[model samples]
Target: MKNQQDHIHIFSGEIADYWIEDGILFSQSKPIKRTVPLIQENIELVKKITQNQAMPLLIYLCKSPVPDKETRQFSREQLSQVYKAMAMVSAPGLSQLIMKMVFQFQKPPIPIKSFSREESALQWLQQFK
Candidate 1:
């Protein structure tokens, strides 16, 4: 898959494409419904890439349809299982709002933060590496 980042592509799911660089696992989601199976694919691929070790995640939030409640819960519960922390990269306004809106009712299972720039996200994620 084509990416703005200069990292080797690792996996491409229905919802997200993944790659790894400098101990951070990066994902850029497509504008599609993120399903449970797709999220499972995401976890399995990340586990393989990290060799079962917990690595920090960096995801670029996009205009994907909000996942169903069950899928959202599953994604939340599996966060600590696959990643030590997560950094979400989004533009300064609505995407960030949508991201938070999706998970606002519950605290994240791991460290989660949002940034407007990939550089900032990577810089913040370095602490977890």
Candidate 2:
């Protein structure tokens, strides 16, 4: 993991800590109330990372409950512009359900999938490479 962090791009927020490793953007968020501005900031950080020619795969590790409607909507909108593929790792619960529901309602421009393990998520993302 240390090797992967060599070119890490960190985005720290009250709710989450985001970083990029080996072209995969990873996010781990706490169970804090999320607001629009905070969500937008997260998106902006992703935008900066994706500005490079090579688009990266996203691996979001959801440790918190599902975000509100607006945050989910905004994230979908912003992510569509940048990601080549998205892989989410979350337990089987509301968080996972919400993620699946969001993708079902508004299909992302890129491929997205959910996994229970980080290794599986990373392996799946390799197809986009």
Candidate 3:
């Protein structure tokens, strides 16, 4: 059987690709404004990639929240919709129940495995890779 690391590959270009390195999930840029359209675009992208046998994952490496927010949690109105999207993708084991539980919490105290250096993220992602 191929190790997770052996399955890792990069396809950098106009269309983004998904892959895991260590334990971190990585993906290309999703559009701004966390809107339905933008989210749908990402979902389509995930579907297209997964159809090709690539696992879908997201790794956010940002010094601050994209909107400069104090926390990573989405706003109150965004929670339900986000949950729905996650549920829609759970069929093929794309989204795990633990992830769902983490997101489902009113205030998930779970610390996002973040790192100050790309190397650190890379090292962590290696576990899953």
Candidate 4:
């Protein structure tokens, strides 16, 4: 038995009801920096739906670059606030500013993790109860 709302969205492009062994896989085509808002909103939604349960979230951070620093920083700070078990797989050559953004959130009071590999990231999220 499953509730329609128990689904977990891996990112803007994918969602799954409950947890799958592989978790929900997100596409590399999604806009990384811009998805920060959607991520924030979903975090609240998940928190509400799972008021009696807590599940970790795994995010695939494709190779998409942020294009600029402002967006990177804004997205980073926003993510930090909604902290959950999250990992980002990124492309090479991302601006130093964005890299620092990821670094800033290396450890937050909220659950969070970062990875360059999608599979590894998902595994980390699955470890959460």
lDDT against the true structure, per candidate, is: 0.80, 0.66, 0.38, 0.46
Error of 4 at 61 (Å): 1.6
What does the lDDT read for residue 56 in candidate 4? 55
The C-alpha TM-scores of every prediction are: 0.85, 0.72, 0.39, 0.44
* Rank order (by lDDT, best first): 1, 2, 4, 3
Residue range 1-129, candidate 2, lDDT tens digits: 223355665777666676776667666766776667887766666666556433546455555555678877777776656677777777756446756756658667678787777788888888776
Q: By TM-score, highest first, what's the ranking?
A: 1, 2, 4, 3
Candidate 1 per-residue C-alpha lDDT over 50-116 given as tens digits, one digit per residue, 9 for 90 to 100: 7899999888877767788888888888889988888888777745676576677987778888888
lDDT of 4 by residue, 1-129 (tens): 112234644223222122333333232334444444554555564555445244455543444444455544554565534334555555443423445655555544445555656667666766653
Least accurate stretch of 10 residues (summed lDDT) in model 4? 10-19
RMSD of each: 2.5, 3.2, 10.9, 7.0
Query: What's the alpha carbon RMSD for model 3?
Result: 10.9
Q: For candidate 3, what is the TM-score?
A: 0.39
The CA-based lDDT of model 4 is what?
A: 0.46
* Candidate 4: segments with Cα more than 4 A from true spot: 1-29, 32-40, 48-53, 62-84, 92-99, 102-107
Shift in Å, residue 85, candidate 1: 1.1
Off by over 4 Å in 1: 1-9
lDDT of 3: 0.38
lDDT (10s digit) by residue, model 3, range 31-127: 3434344444555555454453333134432121133132224333333332211111112332233344335555433223433344554544444
